[model samples]
Target: MHEFDLIRQIDSFAADHDDVKVGIGDDAAVTSSNAYKDMISCVDTICEGIHFKRSTLHLSDIGYKALAVNLSDIAAMGGTPRYYLVSLGIPAEWDQEEILEIYRGMNDLAKRYGVILIGGDTVSAQNGLMISVTVLGEIETNRSLLRNSARVGDIVFASGTLGASRGGLDLLLSQGLTAHRTEEEKALVIVHQRPDPQVTLGELLKESGFRIALNDISDGLSSEIWELAEASNVCICLEEEKIPISADAIKLFGKQSAYEYALNGGEDFQLVGTVAKTHWPTIQSTAKEKGIRLSAIGSVEHEGDSQVFMQKNGERTRIKRTGYRHG
Candidate 1:
């Protein structure tokens, strides 16, 4: 880190805004008012040996991911994150600068979305670090996106590409990486390190005239899609070939590897949103403007088996795996 590294980074992110009463390097942050009828709140935590392997990740990336994952929850609900509170149990071995670096990463992400850290508590743990973050956001009183709103004839779409984060994890785990290594691999590392939550796209979907079931693709796409179908009480019929996977990651890992990564691997954090058949064009247009690759992987059918399917060569293939889980 350099001089005013955190502060300058925050300024660069929101340099043009006047509503920032306080930003990075402050004991506390403050923000100006924004209109909202009710607030939505979500909290998430990542414990070492549970959420991640300490040997495999950098402290800064861990910090960024801690905030990003919670923000994904807020994004899935079509809310704007207004405030965040972080509680950390650090190991005694870590130093002050190391703690600051974690804040530095969190600051980098929170300020990007106008989220301010309001308050929290910190303490030392005897074991690995555990981070608990709660994000409070707001949506227009009755306009929040619900997981139960998907209807027949509604088209389901995902923002950005899938499986890249998973592939990136593979790349990080396998030291055998050689040849064809370039900036593309680096991009996957960035994707896994600092995921971009789709807050803006979720807001756009919450606008009038669109069918409204929404969820974030944090778990493997296969599992999350099944979750949506279960929530809405419908069948999701889609083609695996049509899912928007990262070209770079696919090239990096052959077809089967890429497909497995997309289906079972986790941590993409993109939005899996639904829109009416009539509103598909609007959905596409909105995604284009937001720089999110909106692709329709499937559609909801009238209540049937609680499953997601892939059609290939006039036959059906049932998907397995409930995403990354612990016993």
Candidate 2:
């Protein structure tokens, strides 16, 4: 397909919104901002071979995950996503219909969160397909959840289970796409491919009227907690048993391997952060009411070495900052 034809195909996915003055087809996207709120913007890129394999994931899955990962950043900041721009590096082998299917996957998730497609660029690539997404969001002024806000004596909690995404990726790599998968394996694969951003939970935390430190688990739990500690200039101690793991992950990968995934495997996309201890009961209760699973797996301590410790069976060991890192 020609460039304009591809642009037209993408344009069909744009939805009208009051905040977006000019969407696709424009030289630049013009958007209105709320004076009462702070705008949060984040960009993420996923590349073939590096982030995913075309052999395992469908084109639509790649599109969905590309947007989902960016949304997770907005959720980490406790913001409401408003608009996004997508830039694609299209390889010569890809067709127009396949490209449009990617947009369809993105549109499915965008409609759920009321995020509108604005504008972006598409370019020809010689090597592999690459998708870059830029997301813009709004948060209460001065109330954006930050990584550096953790205070001593605060309770550190994580939303949802960890390690499932890593397990899913492993299954895909080992078993191939067409191989038969157990029910648990299927669930894991789904988690890895189409992670649900915890936007509602993030907004709830922001509305709790408490200062909280939040970070999304794009990396593993160990790496994320270490980020929280180092950013906040505090030490964090986590109870291994308190870390939430899906029964599916445990059953499929075994307890030891599952915990390893939780600690070191990346791309779970769950939120992990610290909140004031006194405010924990209220937040936990409210989250439970919303049917969100939250676990207080750790606590923040006075600054020592800005380290993270994992406690297992009465033994405590310092964990290294290890997770998915781009080279």
Highest TM-score against the true fold, candidate: 2
TM-score of each: 0.85, 0.88
| Counted clashes in each candidate structure | 0, 0
Least lDDT summed over 10 consecutive residues: which range in candidate 1? 21-30
Residue ranges of candidate 2 with Cα displaced over 4 Å: 1-34, 324-327
Candidate 1: misplaced stretches above 4 Å? 1-36, 176-181, 324-327
**Clashes in model 1: which pairs?**
none
Model 2, poorest ten-residue lDDT window? 21-30
lDDT of 2 by residue, 1-327 (tens): 355467667778878887654454321233456657767777789999898898778888899999998888889878888999999999988789989988988998899999999996888999899999999888766667878789999999999999999999889989988789889999999998788988899899999989899888887889888878877889999999999987789999899999989888878889998999999989999999999989999899787669999988999999887753221
Winning candidate number (lDDT): 2
